[model samples]
Target: MSRKLSWGAAVALVAVTASVTVSLTYVYAMKSFNTKVADINERQAMYTKLSEIDQKTRQDYIGSVNEKELNDGICAGYAAGLGNSQAKYLSAEKYKAYLNGSSEKSIGVGIKTVQDKDGNMEVIEVTPGSPAEKSGIKKGDTIVSMDDKEIVRLTYGDALNKLDGAAGSKVKFGILRRQNAAGPSAEAKAALLSITVTRAEYAEQTLTSSMINGNVAYLKISAFTDSNAEQFNNMLAARIKQGASGIVIDLRSNSGGSIRGMAEMLDTLLPAGNTVSYRDKAGKTTVQYTSGPNTVNLPISVMINRNTFGVAEIFAADIKDYKKGLLVGERTAGLGTKDEVKPLSDGSAIILPVADYLTLNGDVFSGKGIGVDIEKELTSEQQALLVRNQLKGDQDPQLQAAVSALIRQGASVEKAPGTENAPVNSNAAATE
Candidate 1:
């Protein structure tokens, strides 16, 4: 009877041990599964949330939605999520326009407009011999309406589209011109003018060069397009043949363009050394050096403003880093990242920031822009006066400052044969 009882107790203990082991195994498996599920949910949060919103909108929205626009918005939102202000997604139409507009020729009214503090479109420049110029649309003119539609409510891109159409198409513009705004309140008045302009194909000249003070060669590069390097080299050669004592490069309001073009431009001036470098996401560095024979050895002064950005900033940084030139005017726009246009599966495309750029001294200008050697800040009143003076072929203070600095560096007024010694005019130089 005692042996039987002992055997029974051992059996009972074995059964309990087996039950506990099974329970532990089940709990371990469930914990692992839960962890994996949590991870998947975290990884797919963006996709899941987007899907939810899309579903709700399709089912509950009152208005009929355009799927194309919705898709474009999604693409743009995805790019905006990258947290870079310069990054953007372009729709099919916008992308096509961007590609065509970058070419040597384009059809448009030939006016460059910028948004003011109140989001109104203000004409900053009218191309020479273009329809906008022929229509008497001057710089500093605020565009009140385009084609009878209020332009204040439209985006800059939309306004640009309105200004750009097929050749022979006519567009009407209502402009607000401020009279004598340079003087005190007693002389200021607003006048409205309506004019019609016909669109036509114009050869886009990105760089304009002229002799300032009959000795200093002034070059205003509105943008660094594909042909800019060739144009720049030609301009430089022309100026050299004419015996220019100094050179002033006006990069103000130059939103910047091709990196290759900028590099080529720098190659002309930079000595045989490191000009600039770029870093990738994998911590790899690619260094670019100046390939000499450096031809441009004259005193160079670069003028910049708050509107100077992108590759233009790179140009300024390198000049400042190598002590090759004097940087005048306000600080740059501080955008130094290089972007690449990536095409999506759809017709849309995105401008993605692929790399970060550094100056010759290995300094990055991301949020902090490059500083100038001679900093000059123009007040609103001074800026208004500058625009007025520039339109009248008068001297611009920034250009004057650049010329003065070059003159101080032993740049004398050595006029080329048959060239008159005249005060430098920024408008005439830009138009040339």
Candidate 2:
């Protein structure tokens, strides 16, 4: 079978193999070249249109133009055109500050807005004990101006950046507020209000525990960070070791955080089974996390409010669905999803949503919050006081209701001691 070929035949075979290899290489090279050319052409079209606009503006512009603003606007417009509501283009400076992401107790005025509707910053929330809250800034208030600069006239990111500064610094805000002391209502017309607030550090990821009523333990989860989740397990075990029979988990005003962190905390509490899951666009179901076999045997009670959002809702939902605890307070905020930030070469960036969210039982609670077993409501003032570390003991009705629920679930109660119950907020604490 081992036979040597003739020189002429061998030469012909070599030629055939070399020709095929060269043909494949040529085809691949052409495909790559064509793809690059198409990309360059697309970019050329965009640049051409932009140059035309710039040329016209230079030739017949009316007033002085801020080149920095114009450039930032163009980049921001491109991101906005992507059609993702959560998409926001951060300028170079903003991107830098964002990367500087701090865990400081305080950085800016404690006003949170998720929307820039109608060119005005809509005030969706104000942190308790924050300079904004102390200055009478409440939720539903519209930020019309920052330090006398109209918000509509300035870039939104720039305005947001202005909100951050050193502690003890002052910033002035022009607020357009509803006449009603509560949230927004159609009956009240918007009134212009102005106030100055001093910014200070606030405890951002507050997680602490104490013996509640001698037998029941109390844990306040402000934000679900990995550190906090780990701390939670240790604290819970310590509380249990101290002869605590049950626990009251307060999650009010927690806008939520890392899903992994939430799952970790749940793992310490839930029995072996599926914890939470999510579905992608391709209609495939993926289990996000599952609980271990060991769970602390105790009556659990979770405190929730309307401001409880994202992962916090999932925490509350798991507790409710499993019937492991009774949910006390108002309905949740009902907002959760996965978001990703992509930075561009020019130092600009975009924040966009990448996936949807679902609760433990595979239910979509987005836009609609989970329900509570025991409904205990509070006024805005009371809600603020209850968390500023000012609200405690008999002063907080919701806390009382939660403790009472635990008592009904076979938890032993004793005389309320001089225990400190301070709130940990999901958002960074700031005075604005």
Q: Tell me the tens digit of each residue's lDDT in model 2 across 231-289.
A: 78888888888888889898987868778888998888888877777667776777878
* Model 1 segments more than 4 A misplaced: 1-40, 114-124, 131-142, 155-158, 165-170, 175-200, 385-396, 413-427, 430-432
Residue 265 C-alpha lDDT in model 1: 91
Local accuracy of candidate 1 as per-residue lDDT tens digits, 52-126? 998998899999999888888888888898899979999988888777776767788988777776667888777
What lDDT would each prediction earn against the true structure? 0.79, 0.77
